[model samples]
Target: MVHRIHRIHRIQTLPVTPDKAWDFFSDPCNLARITPPWMDFRIVSGCADHTYPGQIIEYRVRPFPLVRLGWLTEITQARSPVFFVDEQRRGPYAFWHHQHHFAAVENGAAVRMTDLVHWALPWYALPVRALVRRRLRIIFDYRQHALERLLGRAEQGEDACRA
Candidate 1:
């Protein structure tokens, strides 16, 4: 077996209270809303409520043409208005761990999302590393853009009403 490790850090600014930010970000179903519809990502389960420790979220995503993939992840730790950690229970990766953190900043709140994932193919580890690295970057970029759009919409609604 081979080991490929990846780490990503992203910071986002949102003009919302910590509770509100946590409420929006911690909802697993909101993930479907943020993900690009072209990817055909759908929540298979765990959309009933907000996250909690040991809660599992299942997803179906068509990342490539005519190929659908299933991912199962469980929340390892959860602390409201602070942070939570989730790891893959079963999925494409051999190992996947992600930590989501939130904090209050000057104007609103700043969110720090990090992922420490390690994955390798059954036999072809080297080539898989290169391919997976690029894929992870693209996935995270999509997530960042989606969060920005959500925050932008919330801000705009606030501005419109105030005008």
Candidate 2:
């Protein structure tokens, strides 16, 4: 059996300060706010108000009808108002590494947020790879719109990001 790692890179600029962007993303509790409602995402345990190295955040998510999965991810790196990295410790994926980066843009008037994810499905899931990729795109697309609503819209003429 062979496994392949897939990557997704997305970037969005919002009309918010860097601190505000970092504050919202660094807290595990706000995840549900930005995620699509259909995912039925919820924090199960091991979550704190703020993220830190070695912080384990557990979640229960329903990706399909009448199905539930436990996802556990550890914050391996956290740099305030800058970037954070999380890696999966257990759950659906064969591997998952997600990085969230934030930077001030437009001379501190706005924030440019970047999401880079590296993930792979278990061998058994290989047959459904296309479906998985499409599902992920839908999830991230929902997230982008949700964030704009929660945080604020991007500046006019700003480049939109797609997964």
Candidate 3:
């Protein structure tokens, strides 16, 4: 049976309006731009105009050396400029659920972005915890940096990454 395994929770505040945050993030095509190059992440199909619930996104990713995985994920939920959730339909993991949340702070001058991910590898991959923590941190760190650059970087409450 696939059991609950681990979670990756992160929060990042940016110096941008809620609208800007929503617009950039809601655009599905920008994913490849933020993802790390080594993963060889490529989107095979998805909508580019706007985001809505029940969207199916397909991709090809090389999660590890020489093993290419075809990932199919569904946008299970989306609530305008507030939050959205994506759950894996098929992939390397036994289960994967990711939630992206955004909120306006500083009276529309800044926004906070939070990502909560619950994921699990197969039972045989039990030893992955030790190695994966560091790698996932690296990936999220890169994402944070990319978001900061993309959203103009928060000069005020620049929280020291809570990944």
Candidate 4:
């Protein structure tokens, strides 16, 4: 099999306490909520509970036309309010690993979410890579927007209390 690897790195800042931010992100269900409905991500496993090492989460995603796939992954490392790492056990990708890092910053905290994925198609390598990259960008953008909305709601609540 051929291994084609790609990495996606993102940094987002939120105006909330580390505990609060961690609480929001630590819930796996939040992922489904943030992800665009068009992607059609359904948790095949590990959604009934929060994440922990040795937990395997499987998803079935219909990302595009004629591209329905299964992504099976296991959480290898997890540190509450800090970071977590997930590696693909079986999926569309030949191999996939993702690490999510969070650190407290000026206002609240900075999140650095990185995905190191290795995947290859039986044929049409170039097209597959291009398509994956484009779809990942859209997914991350949707995540950012969802985070902003969540934070905005928190801020509005604070303002109301202060008023």
Off by over 4 Å in 3: 158-163
Compose the digit string of candidate 3's lDDT tens values, residues 4-44. 56788888899888888889888888887778889898989
Which tens-of-lDDT digit does each residue in 26-80 have in candidate 1? 8998888777677799989888568899898999988767978899999999899
Over 89-138, each residue of candidate 2 has an lDDT whose tens digit, in order, gives: 99889999999999898888889999999999999999999988998988
Better of 2 and 4 by lDDT: 2
Q: In what order do the candidates fall by lDDT, top score first?
A: 2, 3, 1, 4
Whole-model lDDT, model 3: 0.84
Better of 1 and 3 by TM-score: 3
Order of models, best TM-score first: 2, 3, 1, 4
Q: What is the per-residue lDDT of model 4 for residues 71-147, given as tens digits with 9 covering 90 to 100?
A: 88888998987888888888776656778777665555433333333334444456667777777778877877787
- Candidate 1 overall Cα lDDT vs. reference? 0.69
Alpha-carbon RMSD to native, per candidate: 6.6, 1.4, 1.6, 6.9
lDDT of each: 0.69, 0.89, 0.84, 0.68
The residue ranges of model 1 lying beyond 4 angstroms of the native Cα positions read 107-126, 153-163
TM-score of each: 0.81, 0.95, 0.92, 0.80
Checking candidate 3 for backbone clashes, the offending pairs are none
The lowest-lDDT stretch of 10 consecutive residues in candidate 2 is 154-163
